[model samples]
Target: MDAVSERLAEVHGGIARALKDAARTDAAQLVAVSKTFDADAIRPLIAAGQRHFGENRVSEAADKWPALTAETPGIVLHLVGQLQSNKAEAAVRLFDVIHSVDRPSLVTALGKAMVASGRRPDCYIQVNIGAEDQKGGCAIADLPALLAQARDAGLPVIGLMCVPPADVEPAPYFALLAKLARDHALAGLSMGMSSDYPTAVLLGATVVRVGSALFGGRG
Candidate 1:
């Protein structure tokens, strides 16, 4: 096996172990992020039984989905980055879940795209738990209103998605999302990344998106 494959195996095994130790009833979903990677690089991962992947750029995802899907049937694709309003239509066609619906305009566009395409993909409302000015997420105080609006507008708001503060521990942020999901009666938490996923899992992350650890350093 190649280095990337080995790393993927290690990560997957780690996730499994985390789930076991956490006493989680369901195994954590590992989204092997495939952004900045082409089908050639991802084909081996598919062969190794990886069915879930996340991508950031709409254009790159568009380029990779077809060939990757053809080679590995039933793969789940998630758009996990800030999606532009203009790319809503194409994104509706490509992704099975959208983990970055942060703005009102984007949600409107996604609702329209879903209406046009007849595909209501699962959505996660990105929350700026850290209150970072640079992140693409709704403010904590704004979540209830935004989630209510998104749901009423036909977006299937599954749960909250967040990136924790860079230097602090992730457990608190992950716990915050889990509590919010409970308050809202949601089912998932698309938190964590390559660096802090174990903390996320322990804190009740139903879905974790890991990129560099699975696909290696991206361009």
Candidate 2:
């Protein structure tokens, strides 16, 4: 196997081990974060049976994915980034899953966009789990209203997504997200990254967005 395939295998192994420890039979889908990497870098993982991939920018994904998806069918593109309300139409058309539906304005934009395009991508309400000032997630205090508005707007919100405070233990934050999802009756917990995905799986993440671990560090 090539290097990327080897890394993909290792990450899958880690997920498998974590699943066993969590006593959960269902598997957490790995959305390989292919944000900065181009199609040449991503093809190996796709060849290795990876169908789900994530990108941080709508424009970037638009630039790269159309041809790639044309060549290789069954690719699920995830937008795991802060989306601009203005770009909602493009995002709705491009991404298969959106993991950053965080505000009322965005919800409204996405709603209109989905209607115009006839595509309703599954969404995850991003919660600012750490209450950080610089982050893009909706404040925890506003999640219920946001979720209600999203549902009202006809957005198919599947779960919660979060990025914890950078250097601390992420378990607590992951646990909090999982609890919030349960309280809201949301099942998809789109959390975790390269550093702490195993913990995320154990704590109840249905989708893990991993980048560097699979594609190696970006310059």
Candidate 3:
């Protein structure tokens, strides 16, 4: 096996171990965050039976994934980055899941796009868990209204997502996100990346977005 394949195995092993340790052997799903890498870099993981992958930019994904998906069946593409309202139509057309549904306007745009195209992707409300100015998520106070609007617009809002404050202990934020999901009755928790995913899974992460741990550092 190649280095990437070995890394994939290690990450999967970590996930399985994390789940077992948390008494959740089957609760969480690993989404290989395949943002910057091209098809050649991703082939090993696909050959090793990875089906779920995530991308950051729709334009970049459009350039690479059409050919990749044509070759590999059962590839579930997820949009895991900040999405502009203008890209809603293309995003709706491409991704099977969207983990950044944060605003009422975006909800409206996605709803209209899905209506016109007859495709509805599963959505997760991204909360600005750190309330950082640079991050993209709905303010904590706006979540209830935004979620209601998303549901009203016929969105399949299944979960909550957050990239906590960088370089801090993420456990508190993960716990807070879990509490919020419970309060709102949402099912999935799209938290965790390469580093703190084990903590996230322990706290109730149904979907962990693992990138660097699987693909290594991206340039």
Which predicted model would earn the best TM-score?
2
lDDT of 2 by residue, 1-219 (tens): 878789999999999999999999998999999988888988899989999999999999999999999999999999999999999999999999999999899999999999999999999999999999999999999999999999999999999999999999999999999999999999999999999999999999999999999998997
Error of 2 at 207 (Å): 0.2
**Can you write out model 3's per-residue Cα lDDT over 58-162, one digit (the tens) per residue?**
999899999999999999999999999999999999999999999888999999999999999999999999999999999999999999999999999999999
Q: How many times do residue backbones clash in model 2? A: 0
Better of 1 and 2 by TM-score: 2
User: How close to the true structure is residue 2 of candidate 2, measured as C-alpha lDDT?
Assistant: 78
Q: How does model 1 fare in lDDT?
A: 0.89
**Cα RMSD to native, each candidate?**
1.3, 0.6, 1.0
Off by over 4 Å in 3: none
Which 10-residue window in model 2 sums to the lowest lDDT?
35-44
Candidate 2 has an lDDT of 0.96
TM-score of each: 0.95, 0.99, 0.97
Clashing pairs in 2: none
Candidate 1 local lDDT, 155-206, one digit each (tens): 9888889989898888888898899889989988999899988888888888
